[model samples]
Target: MSILAEEQIERFFNVLNQSSEIIQKSKDQSYLDSLIEVLDTVQSGDVQALNLAKADTTAVSDIYATFNRDDYDSEVLRKAIQMAVLKAIKVDKIQANYQITPDTIANVVGYLIAGIFNGHRQLSLLDPAMGTGNLLTAVANQLSNSIGVKLSVSGIENDDAMFELAASSFELQHIHAELFHEDTIQNVLAPMVDVALSDLPVGYYPIDANTKGYNTRSTTGHSYVHHLMIEFAMNHVNKGGFGFFLVPSQIFKTSEAKQLLKWMQGHVYLQGLLNLPTELFSNKASQKAIMILQNTGGGAKQAKQIMLGEFPSFKDQTAFQKFLTEIDDWQRNDLLQ
Candidate 1:
């Protein structure tokens, strides 16, 4: 069924029951105004523009209320969206797959979400993290209406969540999800956390001071693992390719994060940094950084970072658009140009 069909209606209702924004859109006229902008963009004779209007604004509002529930925070919802899309695929068609994975989804969304903000094109292929893909499913749901080709996908998620979810999602829809059950974290502890420990490991918010590092520390399991995400993105991406990776925010200022960021800044073109607010994982949101890196050029002289404020009404996408419009042009011109 189409994402905009009965399933979507049921999903929206599901959100209405759980999300804070269920009844807030009416009260938030600016958000409604953003919807008007989206409608205007869609009616401007560009199908992709319309898709962008929906994807960036309207669809997001719905997703925020539904898929982005507290239980489905960033990482989990990232997984759930992947799982939902996997369930959306056809079983037999799994044989003819795009090989998308959780990592791939993380990478691609990281890139696209940020890239779309900068108004970029020409990013055609993606190499998903190579294992059964919960992340890829999220990407599929995220890009359901976009007219772009999934050239190739490589993914890895060492647990059954990867395989079981990927397989089921594939059977539900026609989308191809190339999945694997390999441990994508290299140079790190194998299966670092307990399978049951899927929630946001407390104290992940980006604070100037140390909050409370639950499962985090400067260990192999801590920082080196993300290096793999960076190395993979820096290496596997086709020249001039852009990749989005769900890397930790510490990589921006922390000494450990520096290794990867330094390599990224020196080797690949450094785009903007989206400093997502805290507790995104508080319920359905997780405070995570979406690293939009590119292999198009050899890093930036200085990375441009943007701090995003709070948007309690995730359904009110107009606030986000307002935020985007509010983003200083001088700050964005570095990469957006």
Candidate 2:
């Protein structure tokens, strides 16, 4: 089933690639009219006659030629249609600044975190930096597949394009998800979550006067927004909640980050820090680490120790699988003297 689904998705992408030229050439109104017709047909459940937007005769023929491939399963086609809507936002020039989490890593993170829950059927999960909702989808997929129950998923995305794409993707997956289009630092949500996950953007954000009081670490100083986002995710986790953040490993080496890391240790039980492969991202300079934060909440309690693990590379499937299998045991280890 999975193989057939993958093939169909590949073929659908081919059609989109072929239609790229026509879409770029068509007049604005003509493109809109053509798109409306295609949408209307599909919404009416007419899959057999799925057609590309009415462009030039040559463009239409090119799309049909690409679509008429070796058909193995009709099931894949329906899934492809829904995915097409989300994949349409991949205009590289427009979205170059965005760093999308790869599907494999996202799923791995989601599955590992979901595995931590023993009997929790109803879960509240949050992703403050959810881009196109990939992280949310991955985590939710793992949770639902494991416990046979839907999750109350919430996400915040500041990018307008990402916000719309994520909303459509959630609808297609039939996930009961709430997404917001607001800066995470500015507008805070009211609900606390059981789990929080984010692949935060790498940059420094100037602390605005109004939002300067959000974190106690610094009032008016410029801080790594990535660190602030991680703090934001940690703060939103309910007492005893779990959070997973993908950040640069340099957070452990820098003087400023050491203070924040010390502060984090004082608050949450730092479960694990696994160094990801440097080449995992398009930006090879990004040395990433996955910090698993288990919020014990405030008061006199302090974490006994934090588990530290390093992976030279994630490309080794066998070694990576072994790493994942031992996570539960890794979390139970006492690193404090």
Candidate 3:
């Protein structure tokens, strides 16, 4: 990032922090709640945020004035909000699943999406497990930049705080996305989209009754939420459309893999599984891989050679570039054809 961009993000973060602190103190709300209110205040210039906080109008106005939405691009705004969200996560001791997806991972997902849908003039995207809207906005911003394509974005989030944060983030970024604040595993209605992306929440889904009819749902006990979400996401993807998920590196080795594989056999085509650099995680259990899948029909078929490999450490520029080149070659020679 350029020095100016870094300075701009810091400036915006400072404003967010100041406003959040004022609100948190007055309303006794959590940092995340206050931050959402601050973002809303900045986006709509509404006095409701001020009145709710019972904060002095002049002080709050001065803090918010330092931020000019026009001054920063969507990516910059995203990064600034990401920084603030990270702080709020720490302050609130949010759960592991609520953590924001890293920028590096989001960038990789964007690259894969661009490659899959290259030359398309327009696209629709869905994120069934969107948290804070960071990954969704990041990928959308990248697609707009890389392909100059018009985009329709949609996301689903069950958490109240995350839903509000995502809604505010999208509005602030000028991204007109359809957002659903409901449990994805439930009967949430959404349009079939051209592409879907998710950093799947890892754990067991508590509701056993909702597991009925899902091919990947376990016969006993709670079903793996990640597996259920993958099925749910793929169901909403238009035939031949792609879905990219950040899944546990050992996803296929899990006990539930048999059911997941069974579902894959009848529905989507597994196109690729690219393991992110191990160095990115603290241990093997925590590592994630990007799994690419394509819905059946619409002429979609399995590639002659599946794209599979471990990315080199990001610090190793030469190896990383070579891996990306290999991905490009695979897409051109096998997948796209």
Q: Please tell me which predicted candidate would have the highest TM-score against the true structure.
A: 3
The positional error of residue 309 in candidate 1, measured at the CA in angstroms, is 7.2
Per-residue lDDT for 1-337 in model 2, tens only? 4765787777764554444335445533333233323333322334234333554544546455545424523334434533444344343333444445666667668766766664676888899988767767766776777666557989998877667656655654567787888888875773689889988887767645534654524443666777778788888888878888987877767556764766676568777787777677557456678887888853313345565677646678898778776665544444212
Q: Per-residue lDDT tens digits of candidate 1, residues 1-337?
A: 3444445535533432222122224234232222223222221222243233343345435444334222222333334334333332332134323233335324435334443433433223333343344455455444443534332333445445335544543433334534446543332222211000010111222331321222232433333444544554355555544556554555565566645444555456665445454544453243455555656543333335433333233345686556455444534555544
Cα error, candidate 3, residue 111 (Å): 0.5
Error of 1 at 223 (Å): 4.9
Candidate 3 lDDT by residue in tens digits, 244-315? 999999999989899999999969999999999998899999999999999999999999899988999988
Pairwise lDDT winner, candidates 1 and 3: 3
Worst 10 residues of 1 by lDDT: 192-201
Superposed on all Cα atoms, model 1 deviates from the true structure by an RMSD in Å of 16.6
Model 3 steric clash pairs: none
Query: Per-candidate RMSD vs. true structure?
Result: 16.6, 5.7, 1.3
Superposed by TM-score, candidate 1 places the C-alpha of residue 242 at a distance from the truth, in angstroms, of: 1.5
Per-residue lDDT value at 231 in model 3: 95
